[model samples]
Target chain A: MLKIDNLHATAGDKEILKGISLTVNAGEVHAIMGPNGSGKSTLAQIIAGHPGYVVTAGSVTYEGKDLLAMPAEERAQAGVFLAFQYPVEIPGVTNAYFFRSAYNEVRKANGKEELDPIEFLDLMEKKLKLVEMDEAMLHRSVNAGFSGGEKKRNEILQMAVLEPKLAILDETDSGLDIDALRVVAGGVNALRRPDNATIVVTHYQRLLNYIVPDFVHVLAHGRIVKSGGKELALELEARGYDWVMEAA
Target chain B: MATATNATGEAYEQAFGALRAQGGPSWLPALRREAMDRFSALGFPTTRNEDWHFTSVTPIAERVFKVAPTRSGPATLSPADVAALVISDPDWHRLVFVNGRFEASLSAFAGLPADVRVTTLADALKESPEFVAEHLGKLASGEGQTFTAFNTAFAQDGVVIHVPGGEIVEAPVHIVHIADAQAAGAGIHPRLLVVAEALSRLTIIESFASTGSFGAPYLTNAVAEIEVGNGARVDHYKIQRESTDAFHVGTTQVRQGRDSMYHSFSYAAGAAISRTNVYTQLAGENGETRLNGLYLIDGTQHADHQTFVEHLAPGCASRELYKGILDGSSHGVFNGKVYVDPVAQKTDGKQTNHALLLSEHARVDTKPQLEIFADDVKCTHGATVGRLDEDALFYMKSRGLGAENARALLTYAFAAEVLETIEVDALREGLEALAFARFTQSFGEQR
Candidate 1:
């Protein structure tokens, strides 16, 4: 339920996303792979409503609504989620407290009743198990001193709790170890539904093994150079992006 | 300038004479005379002085505050009124002072050990003259300090707590000072003396607040001296919440003996002009000192905090963290100095001061001074003044928090970093609620 047409974005004086077009329907998982500085993360952030980038000549539509017109917080309340590539550390705020506040804000926006501490804790316990995280992590500061693997798992935990309609995972597997990658993928896989969609943006093909994608698109120089079925991922993994770049 | 100084000094001299005529202990007159002389010589600090460069005491120096008179009958405040000003449990030992005089009717302390004395300075002087003479004015000598000299010369009644050797005071001692309507145009001086003997453990909370809706201007000058005996532990907290038109100046001096520990926290959120000075001395080896403070001010309010930690013995550690949130045209200042003596090798000291400016006109000045004589020591200091982190705000907004809510939450979290270190459960919770409420009100006003 998402569409991007001729999306051309710029960050300051440099044009990052040039003439990019993509579309995805419900119940589908799309994997966007690219090399360094290929605008993979930029596309994800623009859709999530990051204020740092300017969409110069494009329109992004989500379920027949202009996504670019909404603010970041409004986008989040409307069931659009972005798992940051590098999560921000918020000192002096407990993880559980932050999660509860965020969950209630989204619920209130959607005309749902807010959960109290006890009710939130009950839901949190189940989500914590989904990511295989210890209960103690809830008491510590939000990602203040968490390891790279723990931070990734925490992001997935949040995804499970929020249950967004459209989720974008940007470099979620960049800093994870083998076990952490498997756990994060398991959490994402468990939350999949026919009415929801996900976009996985990564530089490596290893994460595809865990959460297999229905469509594979190779991005180069801010444009999709190749699009194919699941076998394209293996082909690109075996041979580098050199062939794709030459053909494009 | 000279004539104005003389005029201010003459007014205080007359007040000192009046206080002397009231009569006190045999040795009090001479001490008061010396303090008065020192105050006259030092006068009020001007902007020319390095210590007072950022603050201007013109508002305080222009007005003359008469010494508050002693109440012959019961105070006008009710028990409920006093309870609202204090942040402590009902079961804790409490001493309530109104207009710098002890209010015995409102104060209570039962079941305390016989050796442990939690009484007023006046009573202590009459009951144990020798003990009072030994410790009083020993640590906080008003030599070059103008406000300390003024407080020592005028202070008539205050709290005196003494824990004998090896006594562990399970309950904290709460001292509540209230400036009512009568305190307007009056000078109220409150003194505190805490002596924790060897191996003793003590916790003390001092609160300065105001009552009545008069909104008249006044002055509250206070002094506190703490002596931590060998291997003793002391936790001290001071909360200042005066009227918006009042001026508050307080000094706290602490001395830690061999293997002793001292932790001091200062919270300043009121008054038109407020200054708090905390000086700690690590006199013996293996001692530790911690000084943490937080200030939240708006409007034309001005808050200043000066801290000095001296390492006189080896293997001592000192840490300081002070944070301020300024809004409107308010001004905030933080000056911290850490001294490492030649004999104090292996001294570990760190000082950090941060200020958050919520308005364009809000201002802050932070200075960290380090004097290192020992060859081998670790000392570091940092200061920062800025607005809230934009990245952090965006991150919070991305999680569905409104922009205003994100701003207010970040500001509260910045203050909570220092507030969470408080060991007293009731006091910590009370201050946290106060900070939260303050941020909510301020942010709502912005909307």
Candidate 2:
């Protein structure tokens, strides 16, 4: 579903992602594990078309189309979703309204009729149950004064509503407690299908316990150096990333 | 203080002479004489003056305007057009005026209660001369105001409302002033006087709008004097939507008695140049006052709001909030001052002005001043000038909204803060629809 070949990216003068290459097909989940400053988040951002990062070399193709050339909004309309690590707070814009706008935009791009407010609200109620969110949160401002767990869950709720083909979960379990992690992982597990794919980026192996990945790749110094089965996460958790760095 | 007679000043003098030649009441001539003398001495306000620093009245002073003629036969507008301009609800009393002249055929006051008086200034002069003589030039004295002096000198007709003591007026009173361009350089002065007796409650909505596009610029000089008695409550709202080629200058003076509450909301969106001066005096103890205003201007339009609040009694509270949105090369000005007297101990006062600029060439000048003479008073004032939040824009854009849609949403959100302050739900909803239409036109299509 997605392909990245020798992706070289930088923010300002510092090169973050250096000579990284990855490929993921449909019906598979890939876990990119790395230590701090290992360019795991940078790779996710580049795939979602963040304007701040400059790709110095290499290419990214999504569904046989060049994803790097498209604008951020166009990529979103083209079914690319990025669950942000730190969700931005937009005052005076209700979450329900924003979500409906995004959903309609994507639907329009796919040549589907836009849903009215009543129709959208009916659809939203079903999605709210998937994330264990209160209906009151829909009326509140977008991520304003939200708790850490709530923000992460709201991001997941957006993912469920949009139903993107290629979703990148960037540090989705960083600040979540054990109960929230279970619920979030359960929501992600329910969304897995035969025609869609997810790339989970995390620093800890504890998340893989709930949403088990098919392949665990260890990213070190801006490159994925090790790829193995689900048992690799347990070994790394027992031995630590220092052992993987030495082996790489 | 600067008595420099320019061409505009000389033309006003000529107009005053003509009014004297065609006289009215015995007392009006003397008031006109005194006002014209004051207007001649002070002349038009210039940018050099501290009060008129940001707003220059040069455009008004350079033009020569003749006095708006009296009803030259019947009005040209149909009943449907008049109905279209009115607020949709019919539970209120409406006093309609065309070209600054009261139209008895167009007005409707079917359900007004007895003992409450709502009539035109011209009718009250003959019907209740003694009452009109007592309150005509009493509350809003043309002391240092040139435009108020001009209005006092030339005002022929307007709205005069009086509510008796211990009465709760359930229906709102709307006074609609429609300025039609029948002739070029026609200047009209419309005066309003509202007196609420002790323990009374009322709401007054005054709107100034133009009928059609005027080939030549006309002037609408309006003044409203409101007196709130002891323990009374009054809500005064003014909406100004004139023609693009028109110029409007209005002054509103309010006096609140002991334990009285007075609120004023001014929404300005039209006209080439418009200035509204609002002054409130908290004269008695435990008085409460709120002054709120919102202005939206684009193209080369200019809108200015000047406000002054005086806390003269102890235990009085006053708060003021004014917001402006300027686009293109439009200009906006806000000058607000809050003064606490020496005897006004334990007084609370706060003032804030915020401006959002949509274009680089748009300009806003805001000045909030606080003068506290009592040691026990709490007074604070602040002013801010800024553009849209960039982080908020990027956050919206990342959600699949196009650039124009994202900007339009943020701009609506910015102006909605001020709209939320309105108390009347119906009025608020109507204004919101108007605001939505305005922003959609100002920005592009909505997503």
Candidate with best TM-score = 1
Model 1: per-residue Cα lDDT over B338-363, one tens digit each:
99999999999999999999999999
List interface RMSDs for the candidates, in order: 0.8, 1.6
Give lDDT per model, in order. 0.91, 0.86
Q: Which stretches of candidate 2 lie over 4 Å from their true place?
A: A12-14, A30-44, A144-151, A170-186, A201-248, B1-7, B21-25, B83-88, B343-348, B376-382, B445-447
Predicted candidate 2 versus true structure: per-residue lDDT over A1-248, tens digit per residue:
89999999999999998888889998899999989999999898888777789999999999999999987778888888888888888766789889998889888978999999999999999999998999999998889899999999999999999888888899999999999999899889888999999999999999999989999999998889899988998998998899889988
Q: Flag regions of model 1 displaced more than 4 Å.
A: B1-4
Q: How accurate is candidate 1 locally (lDDT)?
A: 0.91
How many residue pairs collide in each prediction? Answer: 0, 0
| Residue A61 Cα positional deviation in candidate 2, in Å, after optimal superposition | 1.9
TM agreement with the true structure for every prediction: 0.98, 0.90
